[model samples]
Target chain A: MNRFKKGHISVAVVCAVLGFMISLQFRISMEQKASLPYQRLEELSSRLLDVERERDKLQEKLSALEEAAEKGEANSLSDQKASEILRQRAGLVAMEGPGVIVLIDDSRLKSKAGDNQNLYIIHDDDLLRVVNELRAAGAEVISINGQRIIATSEIRCAGPTLSVNNVRSAPPYEIHAIGDAATLENALKMRGGVMETLAVWGIQLEIQASENVEVPAYKGTTQYQYAKPAGGGAS
Target chain B: MISAVCGLIIGLVLGAFCPLIIPVAYSKLFSVALLACLDSVFGGYRSVLEDKFDNTIFISGFFTNALLAAFLVYVGDHLSIDLYYVALLTFGFRIFQNLAIIRRYFLKKH
Candidate 1:
């Protein structure tokens, strides 16, 4: 009986530990499912697609170079034109066209007692959502407070300020997009869109359509170390 | 058996209400460790049924198995190799073996 008692007690203790580990793991996986880090994975996969497209472009450029060599013509003028167009597409060159200017600022409404204060602040997510909406509406070029939004650009929060392409800026964020002005404005003002959600929090948002909206050139370095063009150019 | 079931129930409740929040990044490691713990519990239970249970062995095996599984996951992540699958398959096989033996013993008794 005493021997049975010893074995039984040890088994119980082990079972308790097993139960604890199971529940803890369940909680962690549940939390992961509910969180926003999945967006980071989506961003990285999109970046991979962008690199693949760049690889395709380089392949086309290689074919063009070979044809120029066969013709024995100095294609420097056309090469210059090709590079200029590439730079403009890469957001390295400043752009100007008819589009809409959006201004979003933190809410001025005072938070009631026991309310979470973060709801009233303009977050990086808010800016990202607006930029995504504009892109979906076929915006050709976009910038935030003169900082161009390129493929590799990032909008991240850093304490009281937000960093777009590593340049820190605060609200009221001035977002300029050069596309069809009416389309961009309509995208922002769509019912149940990002603007409506922000309005619920009393965030200040204003949109103005104009004949000319100038978006500045990207100032950051466009160098990449790990990702290489597949198949054709170099290794 | 009753004590074991009660202990498991108590432990589950305690864990559910606990405020510890492990980051999602390390959830894979924790999951492997949990599997190891589960295997240990089943092994201990089987030993008890077979009259071969040892307190020192059961307790040490419980800690060592869980720690080693977690360590394997950590090393696998750093080396970019999926080594936890090894621990997973081994522990998984042992758990089923123990469960089969326990089921046979209960069937014979009835």
Candidate 2:
């Protein structure tokens, strides 16, 4: 009777292990199913690469045209002026001048004596506030984490990461703004300004002035289907 | 059989409630180990029916078989080979063979 009991107990233990494993596998697979958008991300990234290549080709063409116009070729002054306006409106021109580069990163210090661990990480709103301050300080062109800021650009959070212009960006966000470097730096560091507020939240921020800060051209397409030039004539 | 059912029920409940999550990278190892465990359980059942079961051998074989199967999968992954299928096929065949023996034993008794 004792021998039978021991054998029964051993079999029972093995069955328990098998059941646990099967259930664990089921849960993991369910989690994987819920997080299967990674495949969609892969497809979107490939599409983005293709779009970037096309943008590069178009940029090269625009630069060639600009050079031809400067050399007094078959380009008129009015045509050049129109192209400049269009380029600026479309955010197609790379900006460079004396400007400020603001680096915002998650705090290196570990959270202590608090349940609010989010205080150590830079949020989307933190970036938005900094960008707003830069714009108020008269920044002409700005790019955050290599994504150019356009009129239609969006800054938001996606899960554990921040999305700027629909691209996932982690902490240590490098914000390059083309404007007066001193003014931008002062605006960020002003009394009760963005820097002070971020400091209170334990986010690390550094503002540096540079003689030349380059902001990349917007890579996204601009489609204007609904709004035409008012009065139907090109001014 | 009743004890096995009770233990399996308890394990399923624990697994469902446990918040522990296995990383995706080691999921293959878990799957191979599960197969090896299943194979071991069937072998143990067959031995018990044959009156040749040893507790020490059963426990040791259970752990060793699972570890060895998981190791085989890990090695195959690093070596860029599909050795998991080999483990799966062999263990899976053995499970069926053991089940057949158990079925024949029950049929003879009836």
Candidate 3:
């Protein structure tokens, strides 16, 4: 009886019991607090995501419906503009699959080592041209550097590098565009295309035609608590 | 202009600072191994990954990041090596922040 009241073992037992009781109380409280807010947060986020997803899906559906209507309709600049505008409005993140890769290295700008100008470095303008022509040819998805190029995307030049949608990228720009291989190539090869423009500038342009193109996900955050659909809701 | 000179100075200063701050190579090997594991685990389809991520997600991320630190040091240029320390410190800071958050959320006492 005296020993039970005495050493480290007894102290440890008492401590453990106290700890367990405290933990039990804490756990119950956490569960209680977590329910209301956690459930609400989850529900709201799920709702927001569902709304965004439906918007994306419906945009594509609308465009397809419009195109079907235009199939036998009048031929005018207005029609062309409308279709192009529709494509831009229906922005979707491109995913990748089987695709051709064109490796263009400059023959005149010789260098086998670091900072060689001879290496086929795709510029913003070059990538922009390719993407534009591909979209015109009815390519579904396009990507570079794992960043999917949505319809509203912008490609620009920023001091010694290229920026697509304001993200910096460099060299042998792997252009993954998904669509009908033959149709896309035919469009790219047409006058004032990706290849033609580069060829005239003495910069080597390589053409690769593939049946499948695997695009990567865009690397960035998607958040804007504001700067949004402002104060309206059509979705 | 002054801005050009300032930029040049900053670049040179960073370059000078790199070698001093970079840790030895063994740490890098550890980091690379961790990254390889993460890569292998997340390399494919979604069905396997989603459920595992719901709880205890931070454990995997912490291990992955700790490993990356050593790696970035190994491959980093002079400027990057200096920045590596800042990354390390930032990492530690994040742990403290997370602990506080978890304590507040779970323990209900600050």
Candidate 4:
């Protein structure tokens, strides 16, 4: 019995120590990953813009060279510039402002399954249209469920749930943003816009305006090595 | 592919970051339940990963705890509290969780 007691106490101590280490490691693993400096995003966005501009110049020169050659003139790069212009906008530099997050959730919203007159199920397109109008209305930054809306963000239907930028997000969808809320709301609520369409469809739009909204750091890093935009001519 | 099981995967994900709300006991249970549902959805991937859960009754223990923290964090918004300290939750749950595990295994065996 004495030996057994000793073994048990030692084991307990070991377990306790192990648990503590686990706890500490857990704390470290999920700690806010040294917030990759806010300025870094801005800087990276700038570099993207710079690359696009350089591409634009190159495109213009090529167009000029081609055009001049066609006409057998000295300036031949103008034609390439035309093609570059056709490429329109490129990179993740395009964004909008401190904005509003309109959470449309099932919470507090009564829905009658059988009642034909009062059905309130929000759909994929409902959000899509809202995001589309925000883009159109010049929302500087927008995110549904903490997922930022970079230029290539995708919001789509994943069964009953909606995925913002490929991450599944639920009702009471938190839209994080940094933009002019009044203008962004106006863009969304503009006539025949996403808001009106949702209203017409009878979906509730919960708009919360905030001055300082910290959009969650984007989860996955973006990779774009091959799909460079055409030498920027159009924009 | 497996993450698509039920709506649980999303729920687990959402639950994983669910803010801790209500009392600690209730919050902890809520997280566990969501995680259990998540495990059931995943066909016990969480538990199967463990070598005998005698020391861990619930599958995805960390995930359950994290979900509770998530609930607390979001709830903090309404309550005007800052509950983002995940380490506290982790440490707090350890003793109780271990006791529960021991009791469960021994009591059942005895």
| True contacts reproduced, candidate 3 | 0.00
Per-residue CA lDDT of model 4 for A147-186, tens digit only, reads 7676677878787788876888777677765667888788
- Model 1, stretches more than 4 Å misplaced? A1-78, A230-235, B1-110
lDDT of each: 0.89, 0.89, 0.55, 0.56
Off by over 4 Å in 4: A1-97, A107-119, A224-235, B1-110
Index of the highest-DockQ prediction: 2
Write the number of the candidate with greater TM-score, choosing between 2 and 3: 2
Judging by lDDT against the true structure, name the best candidate: 1
lDDT of 3 by residue, A1-235 (tens): 6643343333333233323333433344456677899899999999999999999999999998789677855357567977876644344333555445454433344445676462345566677777788788787777765667764467886766667767887665667777777777778777876777677545665657775566765555555555667466744
Arrange candidates by lDDT, descending: 1, 2, 4, 3
Candidate 4: tens digits of C-alpha lDDT, residues B4-73: 2323333334434545234533443343333333233223232333334222333234346446555766
Query: What interface root-mean-square deviation (Å) does model 3 yield?
Result: 26.0
Tell me the tens digit of each residue's lDDT in model 1 across A139-177: 999999889999988999989899999999988999999
Candidates in descending DockQ order? 2, 1, 4, 3
> Which is better, 2 or 3, measured by lDDT?
2
What is the CA-based DockQ of model 3?
0.01
Residue range A67-109, candidate 2, lDDT tens digits: 8877886557667998998898678887788999999999877
Candidate 2 chain A, which ten residues in sequence have the lowest lDDT sum?
A69-78
